[model samples]
Target: MAQAVELPDIQFAAEEAAEIQQNIISVYEGLTGRTLQPADPVRLFLSSLAAIIVQQRVLINQTAKSNLLRYASGIQLDHMGLFQGAERLSASAAITTMQFTLSIPLSFPIAVPQGTRIGVQGGDGSIFFVTEEYLEIPAGGTAGAVSAVCSSPGTTGNGFLPGQLNVLMDQLPFIQSVANLTATTGGAEKESDEAFRERIRTAPDSYSTAGPQGAYEYWAKSTSAAILDVHAFSPGNGKVTIVPLLAGGQIPGQNVLDAVAETLEDRGIRPLTDQVTVTAPTSVPYNTNITYYISRSRVSEVPAIQAAVTSAVAAYQLWQKSKLGRDINPSELIARVMTAGALRVVNAAPVYTALTATQVAQEGMTTINYGGLADD
Candidate 1:
């Protein structure tokens, strides 16, 4: 195999070039017995000319090197999606389950139309929208549950508590109000440039053929950028199980699952004998009870410290969700909590009775209680 040649760094500073020019002039004057003062027109012109030429040369070299690095297989890899042979996935809103209630029982079932805009006041005061329609409110019942997806994608949609979503759309007069029953999960930002690049680089080795497991995994992920990870399993003859995970190892909604199935079906990439099933991963919720002591100096900042710790746990949960089928390391999580400005973590009681190798953390929620000072 031929070794790839590395590009040489050719960047140079304008000031350095100017100093060299000055040194050359000084040598010339000393040898010729002619003094070249700073105020001299010739000296000023020569210095300014040298600076401009040197700066332009440096910029040209930098641009040339950058352009060379952009090419992959002789074609310039511009625009992330184009390089991957797929368009960049747009941002997707987070989806969760929400419950709506009426003040009075109804004799007949009322249909909450689909695309009915229900609003929820987020922790940051932003209003999140729930667009899914609640189709059935049982007769004589005051409440019904419906799936709610965030208006936008990202981590901002994940941490909303049950009562936090309490707004109703204007048209639904029969319904009193609505709130989320579970924290909205599976929200994520658009795929980053580097991530897209890494995926595309593997295209030749993975997605080039259709019958292999890698081909199935590649096509499944290519369906949506929101897809964080994919696991493909062939358990038996003609049975292909495809499990798609969201940003935080949470199970994707029905809509995402349907899309993946539909895309794979249309592609016809799988063998005629194979039976493909697209499904969401099973969710295993992991809750934590943290008991920690705060230093006397940080006692006054207890509230802030607690909030920080909670945020850290949430972040760790999201990270854990990205890798499906990975073990939930309680000790690692405890270490993260210790960094939240707390003096020490006396004990971290993860609700799980025993650690199982097969059980991965799907949804992680933490409840922290301060033990106050060590003496207390």
Candidate 2:
């Protein structure tokens, strides 16, 4: 009888995480041909990235459509109507009209209005939008030249009132923090754990993590943390894996290595060889750089997915012009989809076998939606 066995814990090294993150970011930037905002780029990048994945399938669908068209030939109804009562001397004609719809993302860039005191409203359900008080528009100037003046009510829950103050005093990117000053001014790590914990308890999380007092103390103490990945399995039974920690940004090699180590440490394991390895970095080489990937098993499904996404986006593009649909650009949509797919493939490899349910999900699955009628 087989004994009740325990599944091995999969360790994600800091380095691996960082490496994956960098690759994903590279793909995203390549697709968009623009660097993301420094704050948080992953969510923005992935939200649109899914569209490209579907485009590959769209392409395949289109190819099939073209082939089908060859077999279909008939005089159109409109032309037949005009020729209905005409004599044999009056030649008959036909005109055919096709009906379909496409969907595409409307990418609109929003800039902060002038003198705009910007922040979300309400609580968790709040969304981002601009109001009258937030902006200071100049008379007879382009709408783009407005200045943002972030503000909020003095109530405790007034979302960004205190945040605006913090930004003014410390968080603003334009200003230098204590760490910058320390590195530049030459200061050592200061204070003790007791002091740090006391601050943590009394302070808001952000204030404790990023405020002047926290920054000065943090730098004063020259401490370091290392990440490790431990592999423990029977000989020839081991597996390797890489993960992305922050999935849409420029992550450095050292950061990747550190993140791997962090994961290993969490599992009480250390790297097998006590070192991290990574492939070469990728970047946005041009304006048309799109990246994508899929499981090997799903490769056959790419064409359909591409065609469907493309057709959908194209249909939408046509709708945008007017009730009378305009022609869609199939080629451009296909390119973006293919590029994104290629990128995903470039950075993919199995992490390990005998993994947990969540681990399997993280690696992701390849799904193909092939339910649509082809235009004939």
Candidate 3:
């Protein structure tokens, strides 16, 4: 009998993937002062990537590829070229044109999600959700493509340069995480009520408040140190007051309330209602302090969270060093590095040629159709 050809152990499975993802998210959520939703893996990854860039002071043009990699190591960019063209302005003069291009490759962290066969609507008047099909990736494949264009009037005797238009494309890592989560059929992350409370207690910061009136803003602004503010009143208490601080956008307030309500309800909090009331025009004062006590609960988890982040980086580094890793292409590597997110590949090519001398003059006011030149 022939010996069985054994495949190497894929040590990381769905459970491990989720834990790793959550761990990464914990770092992001802590830094951003934002609550993580069950389906927030992609958003968190993108936000965190942006945060990392911000931290490194990598603003446009001011920074380079190597600098960006300090924050996100999975992808790298190389400037391809800056092409310049010229057109004749006079018998002896020519106009000049310029174009620039860039190429970037993203590597996937794991097996890419094959698109599923999703269902639209049913024949009957009913709703339905169906998987289309699983997405697949070519073995050791690279996804490469470029898109960009620049055009301007030919250069005149007075050198005038148009502003550089930046067209950038970035991958959405959060969507990838969601796809992975969806693929994960049924396996809950393990944590008891006490454990959960402990996690919160050790978090960099935490605070509670009653109602959307203002608790959400307060809690998000406050650091990781748990600060529990138990509100004694509910909506329509006349004591309800929610002033708009960073209004117009939804943050942690509503989500926090939902999380708390779920947890409290689980613990048998009777008919506890959490609601927000937007007062009618000229109804009342529209602003009430609604006194609620905020208490700093704890701050024990910061160290552990930091430690986990370090460990994850090390693990990824080791994996990259392995022989098997060498087989992965840049795109695949980018995909893997930005786990729980979708990869957006960007390619840049010179579309418009630079303006020439004659082209430049033609584009200028040579005819000068003004009153001063109107056969005066």
Candidate 4:
């Protein structure tokens, strides 16, 4: 996965208060051809004026920085995003399909009314799903499926995999069972400034009819903030496929896939000639088994060094899985652990594994053992 653009620290207003006051005094002297003493009344007035001018310069610096993408934040960033036609996405409700089945094989048609509720069995009713539309089972069929949305928006309702929501909240005469057929997904909080900024930077790609790879990537990633990375490619003629990796190597569930697909299918965004498909990235699993030693010279700090090494390894695991197609490299793990004060690191698992664009490396088991103190 590509990294975000690195920005350098910059100072828009480099002039200091003293510099402004000195410049004012120099100009005044040049215009009047007279040098005023330190106690002169006119010089005092010029100093005060320079102080105000210094404040104005600070405001000017803020105004200039607000116009830039790198330093802008809050409402300033929102305005920048608006210029690219990218509005920050508000929180959204999770969606799933609830299946209603008859108690027995019914001989007559059964109607599942809209607004029916499905609850998580044996749990509080704080979060639930409501059927978006009515469903009618055929005369002899025992089951019907209807799409549903969460009662509340945001990420709280997400991650409820299929078969988790199995209770019918509302009573239906012949419906014996109700369960979610798809994972609940697409739930997210209001877009963060960083996520919105990334979208704004790439918003130019959306100007076209979604034929370019970057255009497809933009739309797919914009579907949800959980999508940390997107890989768009065309394997054959007229076919474009997108593989998205979620935060922390969490695979995109069926509901997420469907959401992304629908987002890219907008007629105005996707060209008529292009065929778009959204899929989850393949997961390449690996285990973390390692041992590290500490030098005897630093044995007095064993406790602190051990804690740092453990934290370093844990962070390495997250970094390894956070992006799509990130290879499993033992050297990286070793480097991090060593930098954390480990005298030597002996990695036993995950020697090295390369991943394709459509695959992500996942961490399975982790064991960071500390060997006894060794020679310095």
TM-score of each: 0.57, 0.18, 0.14, 0.82
- List pairs with backbone clashes in candidate 1: 94-150, 248-321, 249-321
lDDT of 3 by residue, 16-48 (tens): 334445566777779989887856776666555
**How do the residues 1-376 of candidate 1 rate in per-residue lDDT, one tens digit apiece?**
1123566654434436857677767876888898888898877876777777677767765556545433322223345346446555666666667777888998988777766666666444365756576567888999888777777666667666667777765567688888777666556677656445545654543444445676777778777677877778787988988888766565666666866887778545767777899877766677766777777766678889888888877776776666667666677667787887777775455543332322347554567777785432
* Full candidate order by lDDT, most accurate first: 4, 1, 2, 3
lDDT of 3 at 26: 79
Model 2, 183-232: lDDT tens digits are: 00011122223323222222232222222322222221111111011111
For candidate 4, write residues 244-329 as lDDT tens digits.
87655678777778878898999977888888888888989899999999999997999999999989988998999888888899
Q: Name the runs in model 4 displaced over 4 angstroms.
A: 1-7, 15-63, 295-305
What are the root-mean-square deviations of the candidates from the true structure over C-alphas? 8.1, 33.0, 34.2, 4.4
Give the per-residue Cα lDDT of candidate 4 at 68: 88
Clashes of each: 3, 68, 60, 0
TM-score of 1: 0.57
Give the winner by lDDT: 4
Model 3: CA > 4 A from native: 1-228, 237-254, 272-376
State the weakest 10-residue window (summed lDDT) of model 1: 68-77
- Root-mean-square deviation of Cα positions for candidate 3 versus the true structure, in angstroms: 34.2
Model 1, residue 217: C-alpha shift (Å): 1.5
Clashes of 3: 60
Against the correct fold, how does model 4 do in TM-score? 0.82
lDDT of 4 at 257: 84
> Which prediction has more favorable TM-score, 2 or 4?
4
